[model samples]
Target: MSTPPRPGMESLSLILLRRPPNPPDLSDDEADKIQQAHLDFLDDLRAAGVLGAAGPFRDHDDPTLRGLCVYRTTLDEARHHATTDPAVQAGILIADPITWWFREGEIHLA
Candidate 1:
């Protein structure tokens, strides 16, 4: 018997956050503290599967992180989760999330 086709995955929204510019007068310690808090928040999101990947943008020297997250259900849920993230709560990151649709090709996520 032939295998049945897999069900389609719904398009999900992705949240992208960028770190604020560092003040010329801000101390390194202060920056470290902020980063730590953001890390803690990301840990929570990872546990919840709301965050796919969270890391610093390595295209150049800066505190910006190129992040992406897939919402489990609806756009609202994704927004709620992103807003509640530690980085967002601590003001370490600001999110501009966008909805995206994708189809599985040779690789499968299921």
Candidate 2:
């Protein structure tokens, strides 16, 4: 049987990154800049030890479902981080924060 979670342990949040249905028309340069900014944001999160994992969905050609970011933070904080993304701030993308439950040490990097 699986053991219960330890005290102080709680669920995290996963930001579902998606392209807006009616995305604003942005110049190629502007789009590139936003993309770069988003990358930089994720990098910062990783360095801050809040980004559990982040990557794009390459299984199909679904533009709406772009990627996801697993954040080791509260829902409010995760939402704030998602909104701070340049792409989201620029209205190029949208984010939906989903609660995730898992063992504290279940996830690890090699």
Reference-based lDDT, each prediction: 0.63, 0.85
TM agreement with the true structure for every prediction: 0.62, 0.82
What candidate 1 gets wrong by more than 4 Å, as runs, is 1-9, 20-26, 60-66, 104-110
What clash pairs does model 2 have?
A: none
Native-referenced Cα lDDT, model 2: 0.85
Clash count in backbone of candidate 2: 0
Worst 10 residues of 2 by lDDT: 1-10
> What number of clashing residue pairs does each candidate have, in the order they appear?
0, 0
What is residue 4's positional error in candidate 2, in angstroms? Answer: 9.7
Clashes in predicted model 1: 0
C-alpha lDDT (0 to 100) for residue 51 of candidate 2: 89
Across 1-110, the per-residue lDDT of candidate 1 in tens digits comes to 11224456346566777765652344688768767877887777677676655565566555476555555446677778778776576666777777665554532332
